[model samples]
Target: MITAPGGRTLDLANLRCVFTLQGWTTSQWGSAVFKIYNLSDDTANAIQAGEFSSIQLIAGYQNNSGILFDGKIRYSSRSLENKTDQVVTIQAVDSHDAKVYATINQTLGKGYDAARVDAALMQTFEPYGVTRGRTAKMPGTKYPRSKAMFGRSTVYQDLLAKQCRFLWQFINGQYVSIFEDASLDDVIVLNGRTGLLGVPTQTIGGGAVIRCLINPTIQWRSLVQVELQSATTGYFIVNSINCQGDTMGDDWYMDLNCTAHNNLVDKPHKDSSKN
Candidate 1:
């Protein structure tokens, strides 16, 4: 079910839910790409570039559990391939909406703790509905200048390199929170039963691009165990997760990229206080 602006609800069963999925991770604004059969109604053609002020995408598992992707409707497109064939596709994003575009020019004269820096980042997004969770802190410089920035993605990535910590959004719907902690958590094991779809082709430097079932718990930058082989029997930090699934069908999956923690990743800067 999707709740659009003005409290108008569009029931999936009523609209013929085809297939769609949402993706959220660090440095990137969360997105929900929706494709639904539009023959039953004209909502598709009616929706404008920003028709829906706010929208929420809700899904459920077989057990009757629910997953929510609450964000602003950033874009919409209507298509009619044939006289009788029509479909509506909508793309929604978190508070990090590009529509409200602006460059960040904040200077922390004496930078705060790692957690404080995370809070500052969230502050830029707070007006748009972002929160903090499982924050990590490290001793670091007091001054970091981010001038004439374009978006949040680059700064967050730069912080990851500089602070020796990771920052990202782990979705659980409106309950979604950001991770700024160095010691990550919420480890979910991936295997034959836990939705490990197929063989995870491991790569050099202990990185692997793997696929698995659509599990909401599979957060970005979190830890996971992949029993791909006896030699690869260990934990891997989820570098990224692309969640693609159908709200109406059982065709759901997650394409994940992970890296070993001790993969010799270089830190962008040494703690100013330490030096």
Candidate 2:
């Protein structure tokens, strides 16, 4: 018997059920079925219709929420055909959807195909290394000086690579040092920052900058000579920038001012705070 969240009693306790044992039949497929009674009690509505399919249940006490079962159920269907002979089919049950479908599918006309489900079991997830990684967004210095004689741009390839690296951190719980080269393992480029000027200079200066491949994400210093005095030109060390990792939360990219520190350059006496 499963009680709905809105205090509706969808009674299935009286329904006769059957458990299908697989592997005894074949190694590649496993299946089970349950028959629910369609009856209405004087106090509560009987199982007007019950259907479930391909639900995978696991046994564990999940984090004080209650016993936890997490997995995808492949198929499920439920409907009120008639008060007399209601038919239902449920497959591929996961702990997450039990409530929604368990409650309103009869009214919602929803069903999932169990056989068509895709499944992958992994021992671990390392996005940049063996696992796949992804990233998106336009890249470039957000500040306009990024264009005029007062502005500069990070290379598109470098920025995109860094952005991809940043994404890996988001998914894989790791960080690539912006100070390091992207050619190193676990690094990717973001094609983020663009529409800005990144012309190579005959000379290098102290304020040369690099942007994270993921925009508003991170930046690195590329001063040909950090010791250069008052010179404002150089090939921004495109490889030096990496994602500014988030510590307290999941927004390593949102805190741009801290990532690229672009706005800081736009301030007066840009050399005043050269830490």
Q: Which candidate is the best by TM-score?
A: 1
The lDDT for every candidate, in the order shown, is: 0.56, 0.25
How do the residues 1-275 of candidate 1 rate in per-residue lDDT, one tens digit apiece? Answer: 55555677756655655544445445455667777665445565456545455565555456634454666666777787569768777776765442244235465444445545544555665454545444444445555544332455335535543555444453532222333433244456778877798887677877777788767666566577776544355566666666666645677777778765554233222111110
TM-score quality measure for candidate 2: 0.20
lDDT for 32 in candidate 1 is 70
> Which window of 10 residues has the lowest lDDT sum in candidate 2?
114-123
Q: How far is 84's C-alpha from truth in model 2 (Å)? A: 2.0
- Index of the highest-lDDT prediction: 1
TM-score of each: 0.70, 0.20
Lowest lDDT block of 10, candidate 1: 266-275
RMSD of every candidate to native, in Å, equals 6.2, 24.2
For residue 65, model 2's alpha carbon misses the true position, in angstroms, by 25
